[model samples]
Target chain A: MSRKYAAKGIFLLLLVNLLLCIFYVSAGAVNISPADMFHAFLGDGKAEYQNILVHVRLPRMAACVLTGSGLAVSGAVIQNVLQNPLAGPNIIGVNAGAGLAVVLCSALFPYCYAVVPFAAFAGAFGAMLFIYALARKTGASRMTLIMAGVCVNSLLNAMADAVHILWDDTLTSAYGFRLGGFSSVNGKVLLPAGILILLVTAAVFLLEKELEVLTLGETVASSVGLHTTFFQFLFLLLAAALAGASVSIAGLLGFVGLLAPHISRRIVGEECRFMLPFCALFGAFLVLLCDLLARTVWAPYEMPTGILLSFLGAPFFLHLLLGRSRRRRKKHD
Target chain B: MIRCENLSAGYGEGAVIHDISWEAAEGRLTAIVGPNGSGKSTLLKSVIGQTSVERGGVYLEGKPLKQWRHKEMAKQIAYLPQSRNDASLSVFRMVLHGRFPYLAFPRRYTQKDEETVIRELKRMGISELREKPVSELSGGEKQRAYLAMALVQGAPVLLLDEPTTYLDLSAQMELMELLRQLVAEGKTVVAVLHDLNHALQYADEMVLLENGGLKQCGTSKEILQSGVLEDVFRVRIHILQDQYGKEYYGFSSEKRMRNETGPAASGHPKRLQIRS
Candidate 1:
């Protein structure tokens, strides 16, 4: 394709993403009219109206979209870098590691709410460091990396459980986040988290091609001047950072990260550039729509969107795992 | 030109392909033949600066292999290593990976790269499978795709490790013919071949390596001779000429050496040589 055509395609995607953001703002529990939403959008001078529409709904919605996109993009990156279909958002236990750290820090240092995200960040980074060090010496091997990730995930979860056992009262928030629902986040927490996710995911877009090359096994990647080791560490760090941030704010919403990218891959083609952006949009939409369902389905009482997602995502995951293999054989021949 | 001087490689504390010195001239096909664990693959890997057990470096052009940037080396030497894991990529994308060395950040393929990938897909006879998932392809089809990726790298020096490892007779002939055509186009193609007859048909030259040592390096006609074959293989080989005047050789087992030595020493090798 020509450069002009590709640019136009990307511009169209951006336009659509923007439109979705607007729609997301317009839909919610408060039932704010689009005119008033737009008025609030334009900084209309009604404090109560602005608080209901802009302060409450818009930021949470933005958080859903950005986190959804961010986590999904990171999932796509992880899937390619590790070369495993099962390599979803928490494949490396980033969420668990972060959860463990947050729980430990929050429980042990009760006055450290701000440090929770940072603790999670440190925990996630530490877990990745351990996995990469153990599994990857010079080059990253797929099975070794996945095996290491699974081990770290189990170990960290155990530690998280240990922390919960010690501080049983604070365990509610910790466990809630671990299941990965988005209800707890307000505008105050969501805004900053959203910005961070957007920036990091943008960086992932930049590294798309490098990641694609890295997918073809490390030996080939190095032969082609991809700096396999450097890129390996770079991608893992970036994916973990974004995922850590997502976990800190939203807890452990499972399906958005894992399912979004796979669905987008089937839709937009396997090329990383095509897959990443669509995955991001779909991720956000899925979470927001699910959250909308959670709130309205049992009005005044909310089901965790994570629970709703798993209800839907489980079947899709099974189909992707089982059906793809058999269908692929017939199609290729 | 590619040169390996005093090259030694193996796992920690020991060496496999030891103190080997050889050169692959520009625009020539050189096949490496050796016993199992003889380190033909290691020797080829050292040339690309990939071997973890490198005691000494291989040089490309005039620079030490390690000194040259991997992308620079890739622009010169493309490699097709043995098949191990199946990638969950498309055939088109697999070939596109050959152009990876030329891509920078935001790494979209250029028109030129795309054209080469397309041309190579056709050349390797996998053009129809371009959109199909790579893992779903048959073994021969997979090997062909592997060859296409190497070809798409567009490097002057090519190294293939056992290009026909599991191929049937026709598929084996097909791959050999592809290599021959590559050499005819003035591209240097070095493939590790197990079948001596296949090597004899396609390889302009052969480097026989046995027990981590270079036994002989010369023209295929000279290296495929009964005396040289026996020296590297330590097996009785009877050469019979076909009606088409082609020399066909077979290995005959006579000496019972299994009880006389270590496991490594007594085993019959599958790959006479396996270059990277």
Candidate 2:
């Protein structure tokens, strides 16, 4: 039953994502016609059109898709592993952790771009480990883990702020960094991080059954022969890697992680096999549309994509919060 | 057979059950009964390696629990928790997870696995509810679905904790009958029962516990004859004969008394708290 729903949902999502991709590529700052866009995509258009398609538009589109899908899937995994609806990469400071490393590396190295992605990965992994260790030491519970994530998030954000203040002169993209945008994305960083995200996301898809079993709760998962603690850590590690890779490319894009998976859960149901792919496509589509709006809304005066995401995400968060409580009240009465 | 040797276990540093030793014999229904907070559930947890064992360990078929891989152990013993998630999954999919232990890498379900799930669902009389969400089922139907899931594990032994809690009388009796059927089919079954009458009437063997200690481990007849139920539970036990000379166990608790002269003394209807 889920399979049929997933198949049709995936088809529609793919079609929407494909249309959005074409619109995103064609309707940018230097608008290209459909015929010219097709010719340029095939690498034989007018020189200027081809150059814009290859250098500026294509890379930016890639950045949005990668950042969107990567963050969304990571959020889904974190939500499942932590067994909390509100938990996400951004909520738990994973993006902040990666952002801190990127800022510190850029500040210290100044010109060396190769080390930023690795530094981001290391930082994200470290923050996740710290939160888990704190929760474990305090006798881990669902509440304890979320509390630890809050503390770690605040601490990491504070450190990132300190770095920004200290290296105000050296870092040129400080403003753009806080308000994540694709205006200045480097293909050099995008390539490696994009590959990492794809590999990690594929790995998550392959292990969908294990993930589904984990959602049955710890006792049943163990009773069914899953190594609960090991699987939990493994998934958290994957989530960190994804958040790290995404932050490496697109600064600190929040809310896609939280919003995409949540909306996907409603559309595709909770089974990971269907939900994972649907989430990836839906997330890519969301970012594509949002980035398009960010670019074209105030043409010649681009808004940061993250600002648009926050506008959509913040209210959705409150709605979920209030709706959940209302449902609980109804259940009680 | 399942055995616990000098098992002392708890959640963390504090031991809830201490130095307890008992064995659930093969092809028999062993009911672990005690008052609340007497470590009845803790003992069940200890057997499944959910708790921290401070001193001893559990054994399955003469092998220490630590020696068996988790998947292998799952193939030998199935457990039904007292509380379970009402996951928003279809009943067919939920029951299919019973074949989880046998799945290999990538963990896709096989044709045989699906067949087994359908067979178990039909056997539990829940085939009509296959497409329904597990969370939407009634209490009795939900329990049946969970039981079908456990049975599909194909384990030789089964363990349950408070399987009848929150269940209506008919539902409780139905579940108990199902457990008896499983035991009669040559499966070892262990359950922690809150109702002593159910324990006394349904179980083949009884392990009476009090204050985290094993008061006695014997046949139901022997435990009833020993009179430990009255002492531990602080109740009066009565045996009545039916028309065909069949014995039925009844209980009267002083805890619910409302007057000085109880039902035994004044035959006051309101003062009587008889459970049979």
Candidate 3:
């Protein structure tokens, strides 16, 4: 049965995720041995190992998994709502909006780190509404939505750049945020981000059936008693919250949103019930793997995982575009 | 029964269907026939609240349509839009979506829901194709799958827009026969059709629309006898009776009488003709 296969696929993905998690946690800067990791788990490790495990590695790892899963799941939801394979938080201005808000918050408040995530969520939600309005005004075609998102992204990024120029003290952090990584993440950022992702992800799961009906197109969905506009708005808001939380933790991280959901779709077809969990695990594995490579590949001179992801994601994006066109041609034939 | 009281609806500024008052009788198959751009689909959409009704209202079972909640309305009336996209859903999953109005959120499909889907698929003669992806099915098979989805909704009133658009002749006849069977089972069936002969043969009542307004609404025999279709479609029609006394209709563009004499211009030159 398809259900059995889906269960097995989810299990395999979770297993892979666990393996990557261990690999990431053990091979970090301090290079904790497996024995030390076990000791730390048992609360019998040395002070140095315990400090590194609890204070440093755990938060960073949690940030990686949460950001990755949040972005990918948001991407899947946005893609279904918009009915565009290329739709993602990064491509649709959600991440850019959140990043811009964070930068502006840092510039304006200077010392209020607590306000950044809230501001990011507000900015992302505002950007989504603006894009939806523009799309509706222009008939809400797929191309118009993407174009509006691209324009909003450019405008918000330019504003963020202006803020950086205006506040010299925020410039260094803003630049680091722009080239996203987990270098500066701590429990302060991880806790709220994790909670937000968990809540929104649960909501998305509850909407799995609606999302499936939505994929058939708005008219069909509405005909089946679904309040299409209301559900679309709710799902978009959830997606924005997920993107905003991820951006709050890892600044402007791109491609995981676009890539992980796509890969999950290939593995699990388009059923959201299976695709959502698969996307979470695959996304976590991807980011954890990328983070591990970023740390180990250059050793002392580490690269940002976002940069590594873009390097891998651009070609994958093109492949999707080309494959879609080819399939369309085949359909016509 | 579904009734519209001077309903005017469209996408945006201008109304596509203007001030049309009509009713589809219960336990009968009604067909709406119109030429291209005559707003047949828009009229059906207005009934299901898919279009913006700029003026007037629609009623279902004596209650204003807007007063009914979405799930409640869906339980009363099932709608099948013109098949456009080739969705990648499996036939079984597609039919399962019809149970959406009945199932609460976050609840899995119950055994009863699955039984209904399977029964509908069997009725559609597509039980064997249940696990197949809908996108890979033939056009007739896909339409049947969509029909199965609509049937599983278990609504008393069914509205279908151009259900036979992409079907071949036999498939079209099969679907029409299936609709007639649904009507025989006491469900109200309404469809927008282009083929006048099929509408005449299968429908109990016919509603003709032209230029966004209702042109005629009567029994199929009455509409045929009135000969309003020729004027509405800008064509000449011939109603023929075979030896068995079965009535059929044929259509041709209005013939032109040529002033100049030529071998090709003898009598009335037949332009394009469609014979049923």
What CAPRI grade goes to candidate 1? acceptable
lDDT per residue as tens, model 3, B1-276: 689999999998889999999989889999999899999999999999988999999999899988999989999999989955667778899889999999874478999999999999998889999878887899888888888888999999999998997789988999999999999999999999989889988999999999999999989878876768766876665666666667666665644312232222223213333344
List the candidate numbers ranked by DockQ, top first: 3, 2, 1
Show model 1 residue runs off by greater than 4 Å: A1-24, A43-46, A104-118, A137-151, A161-172, A186-191, A314-333, B11-13, B104-107, B238-276
Candidate 2 stretches greater than 4 Å from native: A133-148, B254-276
Cα error, residue B215 of model 1, in Å, equals: 2.7
| The best candidate in terms of DockQ | 3
TM for chain B in all models?
Answer: 0.86, 0.90, 0.90
In order of lDDT, best first, we have 3, 2, 1
What clash pairs does model 3 have? Answer: none
Clashing residue pairs in candidate 1 are A180-A252, A180-A253, B33-B272, B34-B272, B34-B273
| Candidate 2: residue pairs that collide | none
- TM-score (chain B) for candidate 3 is 0.90
**What's the lDDT for all of these models?**
0.75, 0.85, 0.86
RMSD of 3: 3.4
Q: What TM-score, over all chains together, does every model reach?
A: 0.85, 0.94, 0.94
In the range A124-204, model 2's lDDT, one tens digit per residue, is 888877776766677576556766777888899889888988888645787788778899999889989999999999999
